[model samples]
Target: MASLSLRQVIKRYRTGKTELQVIHGVNAEIADGEFVVIVGPSGCGKSTLLRMVAGLEEISGGEIAIGPRVVNQLEPAERDIAMVFQNYALYPHMSVFDNMAYGLKIAKVPKDEIRTRVDKAAKILELGHLLERKPRELSGGQRQRVAMGRAIVRQPQIFLFDEPLSNLDAKLRAQTRLEIQKLHRELGITSLFVTHDQVEAMTLAQRMIVMNAGHMEQFGTPEEVYNRPATTFVASFIGSPPMNLLHHAPGNRPGQILGIRPEHLDVASDGWPVQVETVELLGAERLVHARLGDEALIVRLHEGEGAPAVGSTLTVRPRQDRLHAFDATTGQRL
Candidate 1:
């Protein structure tokens, strides 16, 4: 296992006469054996940054290192990193054993050693019984597992995944997520994952790097990122329905915005008057969509609490300690 570091990395695409900057000076330090997930919306450069570390994309500027070696110029093979792609990228004609052994064979490893590595990896990924089947014969989850086994057999110092769970069904995705978590625990190799899904980032990452339009917004543990977001982007990006940020110009703190999470909002007999527009029952969650002042707000209450009826006027107040303040112009937390 190895620590990974990227210092002020940038990626630019030459478009006819214009040079477009994709990743703008991303700096991150990942410790050995830590799972770090880089998350953002589509077109936010999360995958671009991962590919830079994999040497699949050229770095526009700055340095990337795996362990102690600066791999800005090193070939992907020499970098000791294995990557699993979103599409699985399995060869339809090759059997699982062949797919898993392909990498070791390319490295000119002895046949016996390749077999041992493939067998071990297959067992760990729960693909031992499907070794004889081709990708086309395997289920989507199995195919994805084979892709993971292919990477695992390499036993690289770092594992890189770019939304590897995106292609699966909901049930399969959850199941595969558990498997990946179990594998990471067993191996404890330094890993960097790229995804647009906040839930995936939260569950997989020991710490997360939240990126926005070509910049790092927040880098913290899942709890830290959720509970103490450093920026407005992070507060909205990490949660499911997102935080309810009202445009309230606090009398003392003029021009600053206050953010209150949906769960932290309390609707009682007293507070700011809110007119409920709709109440959505989401199994365990009841979302009361309301208008507070001039802005629309959503309050998430427990299903057992029984949400307010549409058009009902209620008082809403947020827990003072849970309130987040941000500089409106900069979007930075206060």
Candidate 2:
């Protein structure tokens, strides 16, 4: 395992005559044995940053270090980092055992050591039973596990995951996410995971780095990123229904753009007057869509409780201490 440090990292693509900057001076310090997630929308440069760290992409400026070595000019193989991609890049003809053994074989490790390493990784990934099966024979989850097993077998200094769970179905993704967390606990490798899914980032990451327009919006734990977002973008990106951000001027009155989370807002019997527009009953909770003047406010109430009828007026209020204040001009947290 290794600690990764990125200092003023940048990436640019030269088209015909235009120099497009994909990443702009990214800086992060990932400690050894830490699981950090890079999360942002498509074109936000999260994947670009991770690829740069993996030595798969060139860094236009600055430097990246894995442990004591500056790996900016190093080849991917020289960096001693194992990367798992979104597509399970398993060899079609190769059985799972051979696939896991390929890296050690290419590295010229002895045959017996390769067998020992492959056997260990397969057990860790619960792929021992499927080692003799080809890629086509395994289901999607098993294939994904094989991809991870291949990486784990090498026991590299750092692990890089680029949306590895995106290909799986919802249920499988959830199960595999737990497996990943457990694997990280057992292996204790420094891992940098890139994904746009907030749920995945929240569940898998010890810390999350939120990026926007090639710049880091925030870097902190999932709870810190969720509860105390540095900007409106972080606030909007981290939650399920997302934080309800109303556009209003800063003041103690109704002018302040009140940031209330859906879970925080309760459907009380008495509060400010608002018209209930719709009611959606989820398994354990009811989502009440209401209109606070022109702003759309959603309130969550207990399931099995009768919601107010459509067009029915009810009072709703935001908890004062729970309100997050952002600057009017820049949308930064105040």
TM-score to true structure, per model: 0.97, 0.96
Off by over 4 Å in 2: 249-256
Which whole-number lDDT from 0 to 100 does residue 162 have in model 2?
96
| RMSD, candidate 1, Å | 1.3
Clashing pairs in 2: 271-315, 272-315
> How much does candidate 2 score in TM-score?
0.96
lDDT of 1 by residue, 186-255 (tens): 9999999999989989988899999998899988999999999999899889998899876762332776
lDDT, candidate 2, 1-334, per-residue tens: 8999989999999999999998888888889999999999998999999999988899999999999999999999999999999998999999999988898899999999999999999899999999999999999999999999999988999999999999999999999999999999999999999999999999999999999999999989999999899999998899987888877412444434558887776556665577899988788988888877777877777766678899998776677778887776688888
TM-score leader? 1
Q: What's the CA RMSD for each of the models? A: 1.3, 1.7
